[model samples]
Every structure is written in structure tokens, then in C-alpha cells.
Target chain A: MKRRTVGRSDGRKVIVAAVLVSLLSFGPTVRRSDGQDTSAIDRGVRIGIIYRPGVRPGLVMLPRTGQGLDSVRVIVARDLDYGDRFEVITLPGGDSIRLASTTGPRRSSAGGSTATKGATAGALNYPLYQALGADFALDITAAGDTTVATLHDIAAASVRRSVRVQLPRSSDPDFRQAVHRLADQALQAAIGTPGIAATRILFVKDGKVYRIDQDGADQKLVSSTDRQAMSPAWGADGRRFAYMEFQAGKGWLYLQEMGSGKRTAVATTGSALDFTPAFSPDGQTMAFSRATEEGTDLYTINIKNNCCLRRLTVGRFSDNLSPTFSPDGQRIAFVSTRPGLPQIYVMAADGTDQQLFAPFDYGVTGASNAPEWSPDGQSVAFHRDVAGTLQVFVLDVRTRTVRQLTSVGRNEDPTWAPDSRHLAFVSDRSGYRQLWIIDLDTGRIRPLLQQSGARLPAWSPRLSEATSSTP
Target chain B: MKSVSLLLALGLGAAVFAAASCGGNPAPQNTTPAVDTAAENQRVRDSIAAAEAERARQAQAEAERIAAQRRADSLAALARAGEEVRSTLAAMIHFDLDKSNIRPEDAATLDQKVAILQANPELRIRIGGHCDERGSDEYNLALGNRRAQSGKQYLVSHGIDASRIETQSWGEEKPLVDGHDESAWSQNRRDEFEIISGGDNIRRP
Candidate 1:
């Protein structure tokens, strides 16, 4: 990872502090050098050169040659498209675009051109791709645990990059996960950002934690017991989750391991109501809300042994809770009722310099809560009370401009996908509360589950192949 | 019989008086012959008419005063009822969307709860905080807890014991209304009170 220079402006420093705190804060805040006016910086952040919605790059997927590679093609195509950075063109009538015919098994160490000769020459057909309005083409070849992905820049008539990875074995239960890793690599090769298809979304439904794939497949009930659960949070390691459970007439925070289904109940004051647990980006510290007679405030606990308990917010009269760390773990955006209503507030990780975020109308826009920092550290998405219904809104931390995302029904609890362009939220637009995903750039909203009664979705970071191998 | 002097003047004078009086009272149900009888009859009729008009004016003023007093009384009674409603245990105070602070409009309602608790020393009450079905469940619980605390704080400040009031948060788990519309959500985001001990034992006579 490359580090950018921090400009002298206060807002710029704040953005840098936010990004330095976490590069996965959502997306990178607009970098403004010294001597530029605040208005210019605002404009630059909103209309930045990278990740513009309208000028999406066009890419095409070619047919793969191997057994047990059907799932890989489907996963990669959908994952790349879901990133909202590419226009993936498939052959007419939904047929796979065949690259070349191959003879028997052939493998080589350098460049691996012996088996891909015909495929390589045919993939450079720029006129065909130009006629189809594709700017790049992808050809994937899989054999056993190894897969090679070649990306061709059609307009440039040259191969852009090739990514080869030893995926999980076809017989392994996590084969789809390995495929997701390859998809992410291919995306990184084509565009600078990796795809989030390999990530999982953790949500609460029926008082339990449920896990689902990024493409809205493989819905699994991860929490085994029937305890009332809330605030499902994913760890940075991608194999652990923490949630608040109501048991024995008290609120308890439980940390669950994905592989073994083992859970450890983190002890807090027996009389205090502890909930809303969020793991830091480094997975070493856990921040949560602890309710006592004084008031509900944010607190952090060491995750290794759960020994170091630290109070983050001092709310003698106000209610401060729901702490989400910036990707760098330097700043936290939480909900505070200090101004007479629950509104989003950003403060340093130690809880100093708490300031109201994105000045919103107290009565008109309602109170903003459940704020999740974007991975790039540019924006924060939260649900505000608009009239009586809750609607999702994204605020550009740099510009202080807000964009409302949902208007119908009641949409809330927005969690950003790893790509930062997409958000998974819980909505009741379909009559019952259910999980829904929206690509902010395209205004495309789809239900993550056909069934209802889902809330509080927490998206996982991009799942590395090493983590997936634990299963 | 009557004797006339200066006949031309007498005829004009009599006709002028009768016309000016516009059918003046016909001698007030009495017959008497006097030199200035027509003038006397006109003067008596004018006095009686003036007395009647004054009486009607006084009657109208009295009615208006009575109506004004009634309006003021009615308004005072309504105000008292509103205050009573605010302090009642049945009244549920609503908060702003994500707010736990008692809204100014709801302060009177919580004050009503405080008053009820003050009046009934043996009364133990529970305040349950709730949220609309919009936010994350645990945060809602935390929000709900704050809301309940806000109400409890108001009660304590008003001289109620903290132990007399227990707080719980249902969050969005329980809703007063089922619909997803604003009408339902606004109703759901509220602090409701339940009498835990006292009201059951006391019998109102």
C-alpha cells in the first residue's frame, strides 16, 4: 500500500487522519493539497477522477476450458459486474464466448503459452470486441487447484495482466470461496480496486445471526442456538463475528468463530446492558455500547483476553452508542443524543473531539443513527428519520453534502460492501422487514432474501484465500 | 267641547305634532280633554319608548357577558384536562426519531407520570423504551434504554425515587402499531409505563 502526503488544511488533515486510521474506511477521501479553497475540494471529492459512475469501463468474459469450472465463471462474471465498475458483456443469447479449442492437458511454468496459443491469438480480436463495445476481455483456465486468468485490453489490442492462483481443491467445501478470491484478483488486474464478491454479509434475522454470500446466495444460519441476537459485526480476520445476545433477562456480547461454531460470552458488568459490539479493523479491540444508570456510552475492550476495558464516551445526560471505526482504526463515527436527538458524531478513537457530523435538520430529517464508515474513508452511510419513516443517506465527509438513498418504505441499518459502491440494508418496502442491496451509482435495489424479517447487516471485508482455507 | 283661538295656527300645530310622533300613542288608553292634550300625549309616549329601548340594550349586554364567562370557564377546564392527561400513567410519551430526550410536546406527558408516581407512594412503575422497526436491533435497544432513562431522569428530577421506576428496552422488537407507515412508526417510538405494584392494591371509592 502506498501512502499519500497529508495536506495542511484542517479538513484535509481530518480526511488523512481518517484514511490513515483505516484505508478500508469506505473509499479514499478526496486528496486536497494546500492553498485550495474548501469549495474546490468539495467539488473535487464529489466528482473525483476515479470511480465515476457514468464512464464505466466495458469488459467481456470468455468461456473457460476445464471440468468443475462452471461455478467459477458464474461467480466471477457476477462478482465483477456487482462491483459496479465494469460493464460485463456476455455473448448474444447468453452463450459463453469461446476463446480457443485446446488439445490434451498442458502446463508450463513461464508465461504458460503452450496450451493457450490458440486462445491468446483469438482473444486479440479487437474488431469483434470493438463492434460489441467491449474495452477489455477476460479468459480463465482452471485445472485442479490452480487457475489462470488473463485480461486483454481490447481497444489497446494487448494483454493487460494475467493472475494465477492455486485455488481450494474442487472437492473442498470452500471451492466457491477460492473462486471469489480469483474474481477479486482479476478485478484488481483490470481495475485498481479488488472485487468484493468473495465477501459475506452478516445480518440478524429471527433473533439470530445469518450469513449470506455477496451475490445473495448460500443463506446460512450461522448462530446455532435460538438466542435473541442483534448487531452482527464481522472481524477483520473474516472468520469471526461478534453480536449482542439477550439471554437470562440480560444483554450479553458473544463472539463466535465461523469454523468451529464456538462462542465465548464476553463478560461485562452484570447489571449493565452491554450491546452493539464492533471489532476494530485490526481485530485487536472491540467497541460496544454499555448501558448503566449514568447513560449509554461507547466502550472498547481488548479482544485477545477481554481484559482492558476502556470507556470512549462520557455521556452523563446524553445517550452515546453505535461506534464504527474508520478503516485505519483512528476515528470512530457513533450515534449521540447530545444535541437532544440521536445524530451521527465522529470523534477520535479515544473519544475526544466529538463533533456533530453532516449537520442535518433535527425535526425535518429526523435523527441520524447506525452510521457505518465506508471502506475508502470518504463517506458514511446512516439512516435518518425522515418524517416518521427511516431512510438511508450517505454523507461525503469531505464536502458535507448528503445524498438520500431510499424513499419508500422504511430502510435502515446500511452496511457497505467491500467495493464501497454497494450497500446492504434492511428494508420493509416489501411489506416485511428484509435485507436489500443497493448500488448507489446505478440506483439499483434488490432484495438479498426473498423472505422477510432481517435487520442489521454487517458486510465482511474481502475474504482472503488463507482465511477460507480454515474450513 | 273645545274653544278655538287663532284657528289657522291651531290646525297646523295639531297636525304637525301627530305626524312627527308617527302614530303616537292614542292618549295612553285614557280620554281627557285639556288645552295641550296632544303635546302631553306625545311627550308621554316618547318617554315610554325611550325606557323600553334602554331595557333591551341592558338585556343584550348581560347576555354577552355571560357568554364570555362561559367561554373562559370552558377553556380553563380543557387546560386542566390536558394537564391531567399529561400526568396519567396511561399516557405514553413519544421521542424524536432517534432521540431519547423527551420532546417538549412529551414533557408534559412525562410530568403527568411523575405526578402519578408522586401521588401514589406505594406505586412502583416500569418504563419501557421502544424504537420503530428501522434501525439495527441492538442499537435500538441502546436507543430505547436511553429513552427510558430520559424519562426516568425527568421523574427523578421532579422528586421521584429512581428505585420507584425500573427501565427496560424492547427496542424495535415490540411495536404499538403494525404498519410500516409514519403513523405507526411515530407511535412505536415512545416510552410506555406499566404499574408494577401499587395501582392494583388500591381501590378508588
Candidate 2:
């Protein structure tokens, strides 16, 4: 993997540290980031890249010897890059002897495996790294049934954090996530910020739902191959997701627990289409689109209570669908065809005060669909048809202005990452529909999954380390 | 119940190939028999009107002669109308891009469907709405739903029982033609009427 310089201008983006009051209701008590801009709290981190690039500490990955160690180095570097917090400096190679343990022998309790000596400093050339513009460096060493990771602060020349991670076998399906978990830990120790590298994404490909990593590795089937699944939505807890399965000539929404793969049909009407299920950030409610003989309307059900199915927008011969909840769960941003063509609309969470949210001319613009609200509650990402092709666009909620993100081949279905600075969307730039991620801060676009036919990607929240596996 | 079982069986077989549209074969278009229009009936009506004028001039045997001519015109209209019942039940009406409301041009076709359903009380139909490949898949589904509903609403508004018509949206999943141009899209954005039951003893409405 190659490392690029973080240009100064591209590094500035809106990031707000929203303190979500873990309340029982849905109306937003969120302390808006844009409202707090220019206030006294702007001294430190805002999301990932809002900090001054000058203060961005440089980092490197030291090479080591062990079976399957090379794959670890590659994945961890990609993870660090995706984290967007570290100024990752890629070295040609590190001394292999630096892998040997310098600390005295100790039992490894992490993997519950008996092993000698954990991670410690060997022959680290700190001065050479400092001259090469690196402030921190990560080193991984493996010996006697244990893989140990050590983070070093180049300036202080001291070990910051060290732990022995019992990595799953390279052939196991959980191997990639285990390594990502390490990268998340490294980020926390380096900057005291939660990293989204350990998170996974859900997308629909060829009529089935699939899960992929943030860096485009470990693409696996999340829904059954026998059942046709589309429009996957992730819960904030990261263990539950909802999707629509086409069965018996109708589409129905089903909620699935990833661990047991137990899918229970959610509250929806029979003989009607139910799709695009979006769980509120509070995880207490779910909003979806249901089409009846009358018209297509937006509805919400109390997911936690399994009752209180409330209709939000009355289609009245027009369509209101694709509901994405704001971070505070107080408002929902959805696509409404009430204007004769689909446009982004926002409404209160309790189904009131509906109005057009995104700016567009009635006759001058094309149809916009699939609007997703960022976790920070600042911007909404969506795709609109321009001329003949569809392109991704971002709408800053405060300014009410729109910016086109992609102008290449047709791009649609923009989904925001937990970090709020990255988005995963379906783009046909390569001639086939695939999932792509764009960094809003740097305007960097990369493919999240190489698998063709991927569509409707939904990024998950920062997953905890214990549940980092398929569940 | 029978209609539900019949469609479920057909959907299972098609679902596998339809979702995996890997360019093996072009999609099969809506093939249900349908009458394009009752042009033959229109011409017959004109002739009947002309005969009435002739009968008025010849008042000697006016009653008998006019009755005989009236019977002949009735038979001709019945034959034409019967052809519409069997073939035109699955007839499709086109829609504009992203518009679900029925177009003025498609009104006459839907009116004919209303007549068919009225004449046969037991008749049931399924209106499958479709769209072109231009829009997003999920959005297209909702649009297609409105398209199907629009056709149903038109029939229901015309006095047909709402229960007799079932609506489904194929979205952009099933296209009648394979192309990216307007020609293919115009054909793809349409509502197809399929008979679910009561077509055995066809009769003119």
C-alpha cells in the first residue's frame, strides 16, 4: 500500500462531538455541532480530520517475522489509513530482528495460551524514523504461539501500549476483523479517539445482502442466498440489521440477529411492499416505506416495543419513502415524490412538519433518491441524476447547500460511515455496480468492495472489540 | 386462493433467473392476449347509424327492416367485443418517465378493462407495474407501486370492484426490452394487465 501526503486544504471538514443523551424518547436533545462552531470546545478532535494537519503525528508499521505476519502488516496499515487520524508513513522495510522480544518472560492471558515474554523494545532506530517524519510507530512480534503488538512514541522514546492479541488462524473467516481490532486499539492509544476501522458495512448485491470491511476485505453473505434481500439497514448497536426479502410476489421487512441468524418478520402490512427499513439511532424505532393500493407512504414502528406502528407521510397518490434518521433521532430525512419527482424531505420523528429539505428546482434538476443522514447530524449524502448519469451529492444541513461528490459514471445510494467523514455508495464507474467509499475531508475515493453488483451499502457504527466477528 | 397459488409457483421459478440477470437471454415480454382497441366496433356503429337514416326514408316496412338491421349490427359488435375479452385482458398501457398517473392516451385502454370487468362479475386481474432502468432500484420499486396503483385506481373509479384487481410492482427488475435508449425505456415503463380468473366463458361486455 502507498501513503499519500495529507494536503492542508483537504483536511478541513465539519466534525462535531455529539453527546447523545441515552434517553428513552426520540426527539433530538442533540447539542448541534454547527451551533457550537467557533465556541470554546473547538480546541481538540472533531470526528477524525477536523484537527489541524500540522498537529497530525506521523506513524509507521515495523515489519516482523512469523507465519502469516505479512498479511497482518498490510491490513493494519490499511486500517490506520482508513482511520484518518494517524499520518501513516510507510517504510520500505524494518529490521526483522526488531521482532524478537526484549522484555522478560511472562504468561499471555489474552489468548489464554501459555507463552514466554510479551512485546518489548528490541533494536528500534527511533532517530532514523524521526528524521523520516514519523512521531509514532507500531511493531508486531510473534513467538511461541502468541502475537504481540507494541506502540512507540518516537519523541519520548518510550512504549505507550503493549498487548498480546490472540489472532485467529489465517484461514479462519474472522482473521481480518481480529487484526482490525488491533488497529482500533492502536488508534485509541495514539489519539484517544474511537476508530471506525473495526466496523463493517452491509450492502445488497445480486438480490442478497452482504457484509464487507471498511478497507474492502472479507466480503461475506449476510442474508440467505435462497431468499432475495435488498435495502439492508444497520442498528446503532451493530449486532442487528434489517432488510427486505422478496417472497410470494411482495417485499417484506425482516429483522435479523447476526449471531443466531434468526430473522423475525417486523411489523408490516400484508399484501403491501415494505422496504428501506432504517433504524433510528436510539434503536427504539424503525422507519420504512410501505406501498398499498392507495399509495406509497412512510411509516414507523416502535422496534423495541414491537407495537405502535405509526404512519408518517400520507402519500395521497404521491410517494414518500427511503427514511434516514438524524443522529439525535429527532428528525428523519427521506425522499418524497410529492413534488412530482423524488426529492429529499425532512420531518419530525413523531410524524409532523414535513417539508422539502434538499435544494432543487422543480424543472431544472433531476430526481434525487437514497438520502442518508450522517451520524454527526451535520450533512446528508444522497445521489441524484444529472444530465443522464447519476452522481453522489452531499447536502450541508445548516447551509442548505449541495455539493456534487462524484461526476464519473452513474453513482447512487450514498451511505455514511460511522466516522461521518467517509461515505460508502454504489457507483458504476468501473462499468459494473460496486461499492465505493469516499473520504469527505480529503475527497479521496476508493472501492470498498471489488465485488460487482453491490448496491445500497449501509455502514455500521464503531463495533466493540468483543462483537467484532460476524455477529 | 387459486390465483395466489398460481402466481407463487410461477414467481419461485422466475426469481432465480430474474435476479441473476447475467445476459444469458433477453427477458420475455408481457404475452397475454389483448385487444389493442375496438376499431371494428367503431366502424360497425357508423354503418348502423347510416342504415337508420335509410330506414327512415323507406317507411313502408320500416319496423321489420330496422329490427333486422339492428340484430346484424349487434352480432358484429358482440364478436369484436369478445375478441377484446380474451386477448386484451393482458394488454398494457404505457406511462411517461417517472410518472405514475395514467396518461390521456392510456385512458381508453383502461376504460375497456372497466367494461370487461363489469360484464363478467367473477373476473379478476393483476396489474403489474414496471419501470425503466434509469432510476434507483428501491426508488423504482415505490414508483412502480404508484404506477400499478394508478391503473387500479382508474379502473376502480370507473365502477369496477376494487377487490377484483390486484396490483404488484416489478420495479426495474423486469424490463420488456433490453436496451439503454429511449425506445426500450418507453416500452418498459408500462402497466400490464393479467387475468387471474373467470376467463373461461368469454363474452362481449
Clashes of 1: 16
lDDT digits (tens) for residues A399-470 of candidate 2: 999988877688889888888988888877777788777767655566776567788888998877555655
lDDT of each: 0.73, 0.76
Measured against the true structure, the TM-scores of the candidates, in listed sequence, are 0.67, 0.75
Where's the lowest-lDDT run of ten residues in candidate 2 chain A? Answer: A15-24
For candidate 1, lDDT tens digit of each residue in B46-126?
889988988888888888889988998987676666455434776898977777778888877777676667766888888
lDDT string, candidate 1, A171-236, tens digits: 667877777778888888887777787888888877878888887777778886787778889888
Clashing residue pairs found in predicted model 2: B33-B87, B34-B87, B34-B88, B35-B88
Residue A400 lDDT (model 1): 76
Q: Looking at model 2, how many pairs of residues clash?
A: 4
Task: Go through the candidates in order and give each one's DockQ.
Answer: 0.27, 0.47
Q: Candidate 2, which segments miss by more than 4 Å at Cα? A: A1-56, A93-122, B1-86, B200-205
lDDT of 1 at B18: 73
